[model samples]
Target: MSLKQESPDESLKSQIYTFCRQIANSRPIISVCLCDGSMRAFFGGTKALLEFLLIIKGFKPRLMNYVRFFDDRPAIFYAVDRWVFEKDVDVGFLGEAFAVHLIFPYTPLVNAGYLRAKEVKLKKRLILELLENLVLTFPELSREIRIKPEYFVYESMLNRARLFPPMYNTLSHFFQNEVCEQNFNRVMEGYLIALKELEKEGLVECENGFYKISKSFIENFKSRKTLFTNLFRSAQKALFMSLLGAFPKVLGVLSERADILLKFQFFEKG
Candidate 1:
């Protein structure tokens, strides 16, 4: 059945099964010993990692939680067992195998900012960066069209803005290193000011908290394709740099599983 015809639970199950089957078919397996506790930990860690990855890909937190509980755990275990039985590898090795084969490769596309993640911090810099990237990637955003700040903010938050203080709180919690209440307010203020500055520069028109891009900017941007290309390249550079900073921490986490460490080394070489 098509995804639209299925219940959310069924759809989730299908997605998990598909992912497992792909892994089962593709990755070469290796043997490794694991105690029951270690196996459980690997599964738990993999689940958490997937949840984080999904969150970064703009999935709703509530939906991810539901899928994790009802579908992901079972599917993951099934994949591990299938790999173990088929390849004569210990079950422990499959977690790292799945992560290296599936998760790492998928991350870059998600990090590309094509779909804004839910719970993504709507800091002024990120919003501006996104706008800059959007203008670079899609000429349409540069056109003269009215857009409400509220609408922009809502979309920037990936439609999760409706959760209000709670949503803000969640973001604060997750991004504790980068965001706090004071910083959040400051960033918001700066975002508003940036809009005002764009209005002042005649790049946009702001009236009564609503704004519209200027026709002149659109015409200018159209002529300056090279500038847009540079902006796009810069956005990509920034994304990779951001990921690099977090890579060590992620590597440390995966290193706990020797099989994952070896798989990661193999993937890195290729």
Candidate 2:
């Protein structure tokens, strides 16, 4: 199948679905060659690759029903029916089945680009704060985990935006000081000190200079749904207040336009 098919009005979702369908029809374990111009043309650039992943994540429930993504590096590998496959199978028929199943009957109200931006800025910040709070509040877990400051930033970048993983240089460049000098190391040192406390609790582990959050740790936290819900609500309220306080113009505009407030209420209710 030629990958050069063009659709001027094609949305990102359609592009991703097409790419995945092509891979599913190929070998059981297909490697998408990003170095080739075809994949780049489909995705636009390396940054758009990240955007593609984020967009796919938004459709996780639907996609997970048929196929599952293994990893993004080297190339994206997926299995048709199983999460892991030992050998290749004839999946040409399955690809057609997926094409029929994955059809979008109507155009999406929000495009992938806007969704990605919103998620990176708001959803990612909330998640990072929650993770930090989790580590700090649980002393036992803290003692077990040892994480570098960079991990939080990298994880946040991955979670919020599709930006590449934070490397030494990227971190340094992004977090420059007032004098235009990088002080990421110093900031990272502070994070490491906090993470070290968690490391003592035997909950955290460092593998090849990267701190890893264990599955059990996440499960444990997830089990405490009530606590997390309360914490999340409090955080949301605090964030809203902070934003309002920071932008007096926004507050003034909202006050002057009561209809806008009512519209927001209607949106929240819906």
Candidate 3:
């Protein structure tokens, strides 16, 4: 469709409806990921996101920028426009504690935006530590799976970056099937869709394949860092700047701490 302004609330709902028509058309078992929490896990891979990530990976000519964040609870609503979620493969590592939010283009939730919700909980910090340690200490996950931790940390540092893959595709990698590109499309598609809407609203613009975070998300984020405003929001503003400041230091500290693991692995492998 054409672009339009997107409100955070609307973006949230449209993302949920994505899977209704696309995923429901698939096998009934695939639809089960809708049980809750399942949708959240799947968000890790989508092409809309890869557009920029392709940059972190050294892909050039990309202009749009996006941010990736995972809170304690994460959910993803899959939309295919054609393919429906059909099955849930057996999986371990993450255990039965997880699920997916599957849908088909026909699912009413596509129009309504909540076919299902997946219950997924992950401490984002813990994940950063885990991936940092793994890349630092061990051999890469596999030759096919790039082990240069820096390139792929934005979305998944571990788990389906494959400490845990989707329950459906968890074991597929062992046999050599690849979903990296397809999954990338699925995850990014939602944002791309949202971007389209946001552009129509004139909140932001895109050139080539990249998108600009509507000034709204950025302006709101910047308010916390504003040193001088009405002077009334100092406390509020400080909180955001403090957080912005901490983000870099925290990442640097972890990288330095984890670099020790990298050094040891490097010499040993050499």
TM-scores of the models, in the given order? 0.33, 0.28, 0.26
Off by over 4 Å in 2: 1-148, 154-181, 226-231, 234-270
lDDT of 3 by residue, 166-190 (tens): 3223223212334444443433344
Mind giving the per-residue lDDT tens digits that candidate 2 earns over 1-270? 122324423554455555555534433322211111113323432211111221232232322222122122112222233221101111112212221111111111225343222223332233335464565477357535655556664453333222212122223333446412223332233345545555555445567776666655666665664566545644544443343222322322343344443332211111
The number of the candidate with the highest lDDT is 1
Error of 1 at 120 (Å): 19
lDDT values of the candidates?
A: 0.35, 0.34, 0.28
Q: What are the RMSD figures for all models against the true structure? A: 18.6, 22.4, 21.8
Off by over 4 Å in 3: 1-31, 34-113, 116-177, 201-203, 225-270
Best by TM-score: 1
What lDDT score goes with residue 206 in model 2? Answer: 61
Pick by lDDT: 1 or 2, better one:
1
Q: Residue 55 deviation, candidate 2, in Å? A: 43
The ten-residue window of minimal lDDT in model 2 covers 99-108
